[model samples]
Target: MRYARFTGLISVLVANAIPGTALGQSVRIVPDLTTNSIVVFQGVDETAHFYYVPLEMDFVRAADGKPRLGVQYFKEGDGDSWRVAVSTSIKPAASDSELAALKAKLPKDNNVTLSPLVLDFASSYVRFSEAKKPTIFSLESGTLSAGSSIAMKFEFTGTHDAVLQALAASGPEVGVMAIITPDASLVQGEELVFSGAAVADLFEKEKFLLLNSFDESNAVVAFIINGNHSAEAAARSWLKSKLGSPEIGKDDKGVWRYGWDLTRPELLADLRSSPKISLPTFSNVEPPNKALLLPFGNICKDYPDNIVNLETGTAGCN
Candidate 1:
């Protein structure tokens, strides 16, 4: 009865259904190479709206060629608070002794270590109006063996408002699912690989100071700016002078984020002309472009005076 604590309020019955199969929802698995994780998002019928579940898994191969799965779960707390409820690793047990050792290292009453873990949605789905009582959702992790599959069953209840609010508060989880193999077929969306040499060339030609760059995927790249306040100000001003005012916001950790998605045809054309950097060409899909500015150690609301809009170059406080 781990999930029984919040069951006294309402009784609604809802079953976790797969997206796009009679149900009006669809699931998308997006791979993020920057963090080495895959993100599963549940969307509603080809719309731009989607919400990721709180469950995330990271899979990596050990030196012994065995697959190691890292699982993390986030639970909603009181008044815009969220905390990690479970953070554990799972791997195949080769022998009885190994299994015993693994169990000894795990939490005393952790249901995740148990075979065929049943993830009852008593608390998670209670807030959803469409959810039903006594839901029988289960996440079956049969065996951690390679080539074996794990099945997850859970419904996204509520009007997506709750889900969106929770995500906006807690931030999106960045990890992959254990069920998908590393060599799985590429999902929808064209993959674009950034050329490190080309990026270096842009810096060499004084396009912009390439402090550091991370190729998030074949399609996206994130650049880290200088950490100092003065340097950050200068970089922000330069970006604004070049790219126009960027979309500014703060992450869950309160760190300021300046983002730009250059998927627009005009923006792409502008970038190609000015930066002169090599852009990926596709026969069917348009190339993806994104730029993110992260000033290390600078938290939001702390440096209001230093904040300036990139577009107007006005020294304004955020």
Candidate 2:
């Protein structure tokens, strides 16, 4: 019973994401109190980076409900590896007397040692039961049928052996998600109520959509950062060293400006060629500070299939 309770907790906080809502284009942005409006720095060539900063007082639980302090990062581009993150508790010694006690106050676990970000992963067996190759097909945009739903026919692409095995297996299963930004005329916070063992979960639902059972999280927040070339890469190389979240440099503080070229053809061409946008880095950036972290929750409950925030704009696109 304890184990079952633990697993239930694990399911909530692990931070799982289905590609449907978005990894690159459509993700959530929760600003901190220090923030007002976010400057999107729009252009094309430079790279995009994201950071997941956690507060020591705030505890992010696992899907099974284990308490932890962690976040994720997403590099915007076509890369497979990025960074996972962890933050160590800090101790201060402003005075000689306090310095004397520093050693004792410091966390004993070497796991708290300051270092570059590390790889944090979500398990497959817990979320996915077996293997089945993904088959691709184009839909007619008309009456969707059962064995005829548009989801069952997409070619799953990847060289991983485990992924390869899953594609060929029969029975109920899930795969990459397909998310559509509905026309803005619809009200905010109304999602389709749907579910399935596989893509079929969403095959014929004519309502706002919900996160699939296979998906671990109903909402996702991704931060993708990248550099175009060596010069920009050089200025921003430190950014990579500090992917998850950087301490505000206790001694010398600075915004530390660094950006990558956004126009490098060779770097993005590979990504542009594919219909799918691949996000390499996903970090648990700012927490869901009541206002930001969950602004969309109530609305999300209303517009389960929606990807747009209504308050930010005047609706008339229809």
Candidate 3:
């Protein structure tokens, strides 16, 4: 009746399309935004290679005045992991009683709950093969989170702001959204190397040591660009100046990475036109040249002897 368990390899492409398709009448709506939810991807082929990871968090309005991006679910804890800081200068957006009065000034945690996320595309799922549509899909009214649940009936031809305005007219140069909070005074053998706009000007000059009163829900922000490949293509034309064409990937230890999701508007006006310390300051920024730790997962395996290069992802500074 309800199944939200979906694990890897698109679940063997939905169990090999369940013995010759006949369930998915054609489910579409692919604007993954890394996993802000809205990916009923089983086919009707817009380009299928389908695989996903963003687990629900769609709010929109990431440009034009900046700050209106939702669905950043990052729950994991003990040493650390939490999420919730969607106040990027609030205005017309930010309801739900203004994000519950800004999550009541943060730092209380009854085991975390930021609230404001709402995606229930009838329990979303997406594991497509060929043949037809064996089963396992459901999406009728978005606003459901707690991802991976199996349900059926996905044929959303358009909407979700028209597939994010057709993926912002197929262009992506988005850069620097770094907001990586967590530093329990970080000294378990310290390591926070720098390169290319030095961690976005060290989050705009030590953003109060990456704050998190009790729940920023394991704060996360992307636009990660590690080096080699012309210093990750010169840190993507020095933080998105060229725009679009950035699919580079390889983080589970194999260095060399690249990421996006600023939602392109001249790449968010070239990352809000200056202020990542007015860019350029890489005196060989280190670790394959100007690194910012992106050797992949476990946030670079929780710093296993930093100076990155988990099999060539490069970084060093003993």
Please tell me which predicted candidate would have the highest lDDT against the true structure.
1
Q: Residue 44: error of model 2 in Å?
A: 44
Name the weakest run of 10 consecutive residues (lDDT summed) in model 3. Answer: 286-295
Question: How well does candidate 2 score on lDDT at residue 184?
Answer: 15
* Total clashes in model 3, counting residue pairs 3 or more apart in sequence or in different chains: 29
Candidate 3 per-residue lDDT, tens place, 1-318, comes to: 111221111111222333353322222223332222212232333133232223222223345533232211222354333321111111112234534444454446453333211122223223222333323333333322222222222221232333222223221111111111111111111111233333444344322211121112212222233221222333435444434444555544795555443343454454446433222212221111111111111211222333232223444211
Model 1, CA-based lDDT: 0.28
Per-candidate local distance difference test: 0.28, 0.22, 0.27
Location of the lowest summed lDDT over 10 successive residues in candidate 2? 1-10
Query: Candidate 3 versus the native: TM-score?
Result: 0.15
TM-score, every prediction: 0.15, 0.12, 0.15
* Model 3 CA lDDT for position 71: 17
RMSD in angstroms between candidate 3 and the native structure over all alpha carbons: 30.9
Q: How many clashes show up per model?
A: 8, 67, 29
Clashes of 1: 8
Model 2 spans > 4 angstroms off: 1-151, 156-174, 180-184, 187-318
